[model samples]
Structures are given as C-alpha cells and as structure tokens.
Target: MTNFKITLYTDPVCAWCFIGHRTLDQAITLYQRTYPGGRHDMFEFIYHPFYLRNTKPEEGRMTLEDAMLAKNGTEAKVLAIKTKMQRIGTAHGILFNYDSKVGSTKLAHVLIQQAGRHRGAEVQKEMVGAMYSMHFEQGGNINNLDELVAVAVKVGVSEQDAHAWLRDDQVGAEVDELARTAREELGVTSVPTIEIGGLRLEGAEDVGGIMEALVSVKEKEIAVGGAQDPF
Candidate 1:
C-alpha cells in the first residue's frame, strides 16, 4: 500500500552492505528533510536477505582481506578498499573495523527475516545495524544462537523470545523466500542490490550511479502521476 518502496537486497557479512546501508541511510534522511511528506505513505524499505558466500560453502570462513588476496587483489587493492570504506563510514558516523572476522551471514540474514515480521520495517533497520556492527566491529559469531540472541536483545528484541526462536526456525521459510526472490526472480547474484520502486541498484556503494538512477526514477514516477502497485 505504499507509493515509494525501496527493496535493499543484501547479506550480513558483506562489508559493502554495511557501507551501502550507511549511504542509503544518509540519502533517505536527506530525502525526507528535503521533501517533508514527499514520502507520505510514500515509503517502505523491504530488506531482502541473500548470502554472498553460500555458492561455495566448503570455502569456509574468510576475512575480507583473505577474500581479497584469494581473488588476486593485491595489498594496494586491499588498502584502497579499506580506505574507501573507512572514509565513507566515518563520514556517515559509522566506525568500521576492517579486520573483523567474516562468518556465515545466513543466520544473521535469517534473524533479519524474522525481525521484519516480528518487528516492523523501521525496527528491522535497527536489527540490521546491530547485527552488522556485531560482525564488522565486535567480531561476534553470527552462526551462534547465543550471539545472535544477544545482538537482537541489544536492539530491543526480547532476549527470551530471541533464544526461543533460535531453536524454532519459524522464519526459515521467509528467509528462503528472500533468497529465492533475489536470485530467481530478480536475477541478483551479488550483494547490496537495491531495487526501489522498480529502480535497480546492483552495488550499494556505487554512489553517483545510484543517486542519478534514484532521481531519474523519482522524476519518472512524477511524470506518470505517481508510483503504482507491484502487487
């Protein structure tokens, strides 16, 4: 029932998702400030969960540095990535620690799926931030139930309920739905793919391109009177 909806498909352990998240938050905040109720009934953010590492499970856990090196990215390349991410993160008031352990993002993404339903879209944002910070900053284990519960509780989810749900797997189907929709339906094989009102963003950190695309989409909507239902 919303006119302007942004679907941000991402993984938990992705450094770029965290980066993109910070950028999107800034852009959205700026959007609201500039156009007040321009987003009236006007906006909804659907967080779509997709794992960037699931394609190679046997690959095991790999840090960003290791992943970079394995992919033939040199020390200079790694430093460049680190610098860019840190600069942007600092600008967005986010402190990112690049050396954090990168674990399986599935459970964390699953927690986000559960949070989307149990909590609302707005609260889901907080849940996402907490989980990302845990992995990227505190270096917590996303695969651990206790750690996940702790993250959820830090973001105001009930500690007891979070623990209970860890065993329940109540939202496993919803998590799978996010993955399937992104891959099969939307043809997204990458992380941080954001689709807003039919506007597509393959990489969240691609700032200039995404901003231009977003403005163009907004103008197109205005030209057509307004956004229509995707349902």
Candidate 2:
C-alpha cells in the first residue's frame, strides 16, 4: 500500500478554485468506487491556503469587478466565463453565486491555519469548504472577520479560539509566510494549484484528468519501490 499526499493550494475567493474543489471531491469519490479498498486509504488530500491577491486584510482590496477590469477584461467576458461555469456547475449539481464583493484572503487563510492546528485536517477541510461556500455559494465576504468567524464556528472551531487566532499577529505572520513559501519556493502564483505526489495540476482541472494524474503517480511509486531489492 502506498500513501499519497495531495497538497491543494487554493484561495477561497477564487471561483475556479471553488470549482476545483468540487471536481477534486468527485474525482476522489470516483477513484475510490472504481478501485475500491487500497485506493481509498492511499490518497490523503490536504488544503493549503494561497493568497491569490497577495494583499493583507489591513490593506484596502479591490472589488471583484474592479479586479477583472484591471486585468483588461470586459464585463461581457466575465459574464461569459460565469455563464460557462454555471453551465458546468449545474451539470455537477454545484451552484456558484459569485455575487459577493471580492477582497483579500488573508483572514480566511489565518482561520484555515488555526483550524488545522486546533482541530485536524478533516476539520480544516470542512472549514475550507465552508469558507468557499460562504463566499461562492451564499454571496458572503470571506475577508470579513465576523463572517469568517461564523463559518469557523460552523465547522466546530470555538469562536473564542477563532477570534484569538485571527487577532494574533503571529498567526497572521504565519499565514503570510505560507503565502511566501508557496510563491518563492513552490512557484505557485496561481490559485487551485494541486500538487499530488509531487505532480502538480494547476488551474481548473477536469475530474478524469485529475484521476489519471493520481493513478500515474501511484504507478510510478510502485515501479520505484519494485526496483529496490530488500534483503
């Protein structure tokens, strides 16, 4: 049996990262059902909060509309992409309300890190999912500490602990360091960059493609293991 670690670098505010989350969930489920037994325990997916905006919450942030405009994309282009996302999401039963104002993910990353530390990875994943749902599904601002703390509580994180982590300068610095490491070391300038067993799948990826990548990595691990002679 081989253990595979999948590090998902994502921002809660990214619409496609939300889609990537759903796709990854589906791919994992499909892989388990298709291979059964060993495959289920072989893969472990961990979420790493990536600040795509590279802005601190204390720093004033741009709205979603303004950000797109700054990228030189017209409203029509944005609408077209949203329409496509809606169509694909509907097919997968995932609804994305992109109605919330966009801002930095600094606070959200802090909450995620706290959850992982105090709770566990499973709890952290739930918190991450809730953060995404609040922003993308319910049209809530994840950058708002109140809104974020509510989501954290919903995921079983104590409100007191949540607030403490959010207000702590060390925690905020830790989150910043994570973003720095992802940028400087991992070369991750984009959201939804998934590294599965050292093989990265960046941007939006389809379920089938992600599953194929996972299988390929597993096969490589097996081959490498088989080549070694144990006395």
Candidate 3:
C-alpha cells in the first residue's frame, strides 16, 4: 500500500514538463529529509506518454525554432523567451536549454511506454530524465532513432532490448493507444499534466502546493483507515 500515487503525462521535448519533474523531484527530496524514515517508498511516481504532436500523424512535426518563431514572430522575441525560460529554470535550480531541434516525439513516447512496462517506474524516470537532458542539454535530436537508442542504452536498458522493443509494432501501438486515451478520456491538452491524490494538476504547478496536497490526502486516507489501500 503506497501513501500516494502520481501519474504524470508528459512529452520528451517539453520544457515545462521537465520543470514539473524537477519541482516534484526537489519536493520529494525535501520531504525525505524532513521525515528521514524511508518514507519515499510510500509514494509512487508514474510517467505516461503524452505525445503533443500525435493529433496529426501524417503532418510533419514542427521544429522548436519554427514553433518559437511562429509564436513570437521574430527571432528577437524568441530569444527573449528563451532567456526568460533560462532565468526561471535557474531560479529553481533547473536547466532549460533551447538548443535542440525539437521534432516529432512519437517514437520517444513509444520507448518511454516500453520502459515503463519492462523496467518499472524508477527506470522509466531515468529514461525520461535522460531523454530530456539529451534534447534540452546536449541538443540531441530525440526523434532520431539512433540517438534514442543511445539514450535507452545509456539508461541501462540494453541496446539489444531497446532495438527489439522499437521493432515491435504492438509496443508502438500500445503507446499510441495510451496517448489517445489520455487525450480523449483525460482531456489532457498539455504537458506535465499530473494526477496526484485524485487531483489533476496542469503545467508547472508550485512544488510546495503539490506537497501540501499530498500531505492532506495522506492524512485523510489515514484518518479513514484507507491507508492500506493502494493509491
């Protein structure tokens, strides 16, 4: 029986999703330090595939630069947003590198879903962080199969296993189905949409607020003698 469960819907190339992850990561660290009783295991963090570009599979994906340019209408405005993102990330001890050529994340989502199936949540988290860092920090093309395979291998998912998973059409189908369900059923139109303690939080929500919500939920569950139930 876990104290709580958090289901995070995200995409690999999404900057805000990465920030949300960092925020929760920091909060968990703080919570552990304050409790110091291995209470971290009482919570489960699960990642789900949310392909932002899945609506139109046939239409080609947009590059990060193109998307930014479309929104800002000028390179100068785009650069300003980039600088603002860096400042915001730095204030929270997080990094937001805008150097990667962001393209389709369909394949990356497939790999993440596969990782969750075979390697479990911790490994999936590692894969998520690796993919995010590869794209956001090292400017790697996450859409590239070779680069994705490299990231999979780097995260302890064997190269052979990753190749096999990628080659499996059923696995890819499962990932697509999950993404579809998220959009059609959960109404998740954005990245970093987290369902925690029966509440769905969108975007980069405050860490302190999330922690407070978790604590409140846990207390209620305990009071109701439902702490033994799986969250």
Which candidate has the highest TM-score of all?
A: 2
By lDDT, the better pick of 2 and 3 is 2
Candidate 2 per-residue lDDT over residues 1-231, each given as its tens digit:
657788999888787898888888888888766743434445666777677775656653455556666665688887777789789878666687656767778888888888888888888889888887888778787678889999988988788988998887898888788888998998998989999878899987999989898677767866878322122
Model 3: per-residue Cα lDDT at residue 140: 74
Q: In model 1, which regions exceed 4 Å deviation?
A: 36-41, 55-62, 206-214, 227-231
Model 3 C-alpha lDDT per residue in residues 1-231, reported as the tens digit of each score: 345688999988788887887888877776655533426446677778888753343333455667789767999998888887798788777665555767777888888878888999889889888888888777677677888899999989888999887778897787788888999998999988988888887887777877776666766766888655322
Q: Give the Å error, residue 175, model 1.
A: 2.0
46 Cα displacement, candidate 1 (Å): 0.8
Candidate 1, poorest ten consecutive residues by summed lDDT: 55-64
**Which ranking of candidates, highest TM-score first?**
2, 3, 1
Model with the higher lDDT, candidate 1 or 2 = 2
Q: What lDDT does each candidate get?
A: 0.72, 0.78, 0.77
Best by lDDT: 2
Candidate 3: which stretches are off by over 4 Å?
A: 35-41, 54-63, 228-231
Residue-wise lDDT of candidate 1 within 1-231, one digit each (tens)?
A: 135678888888787788888777766656544542434435678888886765432233566567666665688887887788778777766676655556566667777877777888877889898888887777565566677899889888898878766555657666767788888987998978888768777776545565565566676876777754232
